[model samples]
Target: MWSLTMRASTSVAPPGAKTTMTLIWRLGNSWALRGAAPATSRATAAAIRRFIPIIPLPVDGVGRPSLRFIGRNAFQKGPSTVSETENVFRPATPRPAHEGNGMPQSGRTDGPKDPYLLASLHRGLEVLDCFGARNSWSLADLSTHLGESKATIFRVLHTLEQFGYLAKDAATGRYAPGLGLHALGAAAVRHEQLRWQALPPLQDLAESTGETVHVGILHDGVVVTVQIVDGTRAVRMHSAVGKRSPAHASALGKVLMAYLPDGEVDAVIAAQGMARFTERTLTTPGGLREALHRARLDGYAQDEEEIEAGLRCLAAPITDHSGRPTAALAISAPASRMDPARVAALVPQVKATALRISRMLGSPSMAAA
Candidate 1:
């Protein structure tokens, strides 16, 4: 329902004269006008004073961005605009619970280490986690799951919707997982297993080869080194775990990228743009695709100073029980020792070790391309 109220002070007025009017307006559950008044004539003033409408205020409320988005100089042309919205609406995208020290809702109740900050954000994530079991849920459903109120759930859902973690289906009035959820899920799943299993193999490789060895998994178009086993020898490569190396510059990365479905591999190369790392790194996707093809056929891949000036690496795909490569295991040493003959000597050993680890992990022969 809608209502309009006009209030004016009594004044001397002729029959045909105008007057000033003050209007208060409201819609269902919302107040649109507070106290807007217009100046007019004397007779009109009396008429306006008599024109008061005794009506009920609107009953429904309109949604608005919280104070998080408000600013005094909202449209200013100076530094005042810098404060802007400050990410309160979407709060910094939450890292997965598995990341850092953040606890999953299913786990601890001790809360974040920096408990004073991001507490509300942790609560919001708990709400998102509730959506994991069901495909879609309404505010009431979320409230029931999390023991929160409909209003609270709605606010969190609205904020999440704005942030792209959840999307509301206007037709059904339910919220479903958004693309960001899918991306995070994919990233989590892809890293969850391959990385853990690769650790033992990398350690063994470093022990056997007396050189630095690493296990890298492909993600977002790059081979991110998630595990590294440093060489025991004093004259060994110095690199850290979790460092991201280019697919083209890395023998293991190229082989891992190569094993992806052709179209998927092309999509990755297109997105990452095969820029050169070293003169020996494959600089073109077509060239890489060919290299991948050869790696698939040869059962091993090599980087001959492709990543760094004095480094060479021999890599073999770690096959699943299905015999398809899920990841690549590589041994990296100085070019002085990992020359053509040395790589040739190590290739079979690398392949054999990778096969042993693959079998231990229960991967089928189908992992081979």
Candidate 2:
């Protein structure tokens, strides 16, 4: 949306320079800004001419305003008021000629591939992307973050809420993902097949070991918990299906990273710094490298109070048909319950369960490495 402000010159106008400015806001997905400035002296007119902006200045990202400088001759001055119509819908970042059909990248590369793509749709999806950084957002916060007007954000929120993609809390005036989004998200997960394939074995392992079990995959240098079977014990690790944790601190993450090509481990370390969750958490790249080496040699990884002060874990890699370590299975228990003997016993169970899942995925040779 667009709003116009006037800084009138104290000098008198050409009798007709007295004009009113109108707010150009969002109407559905489109914007129509109607503006009129007074016809004044060349100096005064030039001073105020900048009030008419050409584009909605979205900060190359979340929110937006308008700040395009027009040439001095772009305005047409009538005897009374200066009138202009500015279009706010514009494409995103410019790309080389070959990168796109030029209809504008939807910002969401995985979204629909329709040729007649709508700018408003891309903007709506960008709103969704912001949630990745934080769980909930207020309308004002989103407007400030995205640099768009509250009116524009409200329309987008209203539309998203109508579709059940976003839920609003009447008490807090903040928005979070709704059940409809959850259903769509579950349907859209790339790990759906992996979760189903690993669930049975994971459940069996949890029952056999009386410890919590989790199957997680690496995403953006973080471990995303995909499948979980709570341990039968009264005091087991608490986890959820979509929880994410730092990679280098978790056994599941370390075991999976152990199978990556030589430099990728360092690359991940460089991209995502290994934050120390506990005193035992690996902080240096060298320490993590050695740990990963041991994970590779032993066919499993261990987390001895690395992720949590009193929780220990052992994880083994689950391979795909190509024998690629696509995921990892881990067993977790309280530190007091998992000493050397207990951990040694659980290691084999976790490995066997992971291997069973690997076999289910048609891994030809997920042999001990």
Candidate 3:
């Protein structure tokens, strides 16, 4: 599974500068060979070329600043060398999907070991994985968690921080997911089918109800806003996509969680604790259990200022082909305008539009549910 190719280039050595051999090693979809031997002697250059095993390779590929690390570390210049660096293998810009949507997204090193896998890359990815379970990680926390030496973890974290995949605080030195990761996540979400199918209907719902609409999906036990449509009303929920919110505090989260089996529901609850956001927010498992049961039975979920004092939300599940709820369609409005009577009127509309979106997703069981 491994191959070696080598090439060299020639450049003029200035006065008192030692003759140098510039060698470039590239991997992935494209490769290059740049540098030259001392042009002082053609015979010497020919001798070097004969000894070198690498030749110029044909190039064909686009490139970007990929963060995956491979090759040798920076070395100090020796007596005979003016300046030199070891091989740096730069892969193609568009990384393969299995590596994780251009972020090379996964960092689990626990699986079956691959000899070719870079331990540093694996460790860095694992660091990224910790962020999903929680927001920030300190170097000590990661070092203890990974059972890696402090020096190794420090190097891994430093490398990732330099690449923009992880951000480190100046005073605290606590690390968090950076903008680079968010950008990659956005790129991946833009290609997801669920958001694509739900967009039109969600827009329509926002227009009809004159309320802000959100399409939320369950991620790591919390509700994440995937798509948002602004309402026509001047006073509306000013929301952004990709926001993570508590499951017990929002109708969107409750509706999405209702369809899960008890075991998975427990997992979600375990991962995302029931933190009370407002007086009405469900803090006890028993109360949230009841709410989820009500959601499954009624085909919808409601948040009566549970998450925010003046905002109310109603949500219905959007099922996939297997009839499992893959996402939730929800609308948020000011509580003053969403009285019991208006809620009753809006319930049918919310459920119907969610059903429509589910149908578009090839949900065979929406009618039966």
Best TM-score among the predictions, by candidate number: 1
lDDT per residue for candidate 3 within 115-230, as digits (tens), equals: 89887677778777888977888888777666667899899888888888889999998998888899899646543877877889988889898999888988888889988899
- How far residue 213's Cα lies from its native spot in candidate 1, in Å, is 1.2
| Cα-based RMSD of candidate 3 | 16.5
Backbone clashes under 3 angstroms, per model: 32, 9, 9
Score candidate 3 by lDDT: 0.74
> Per-prediction TM-score, please?
0.55, 0.51, 0.52
Candidate 1 TM-score to native: 0.55
Clashing pairs in 3: 6-54, 9-35, 9-36, 9-37, 10-35, 10-36, 10-37, 107-125, 107-126
Regions of model 3 farther than 4 Å from truth: 1-191, 367-369
Candidates arranged by lDDT, highest first: 2, 3, 1
lDDT for each residue of candidate 1 in 51-126, tens digit (9 for 90 to 100): 4332211111121111221232421221212133233112222334334433223221233256376767877877
> In candidate 2, what are the lDDT values of residues 1-369, reduced to their tens digit?
233332323444343233333333233323233333446688865554454333212222211212232333332221122223233223333333433443333244333246787879877987888777778999997776666689999999999999999999999999999888898886455368788878898889888888999999998888999999999999999899999988899998899899998788878898899888889999998899999999999999989899889998889999887788889999988999999998887777888888899888778886443
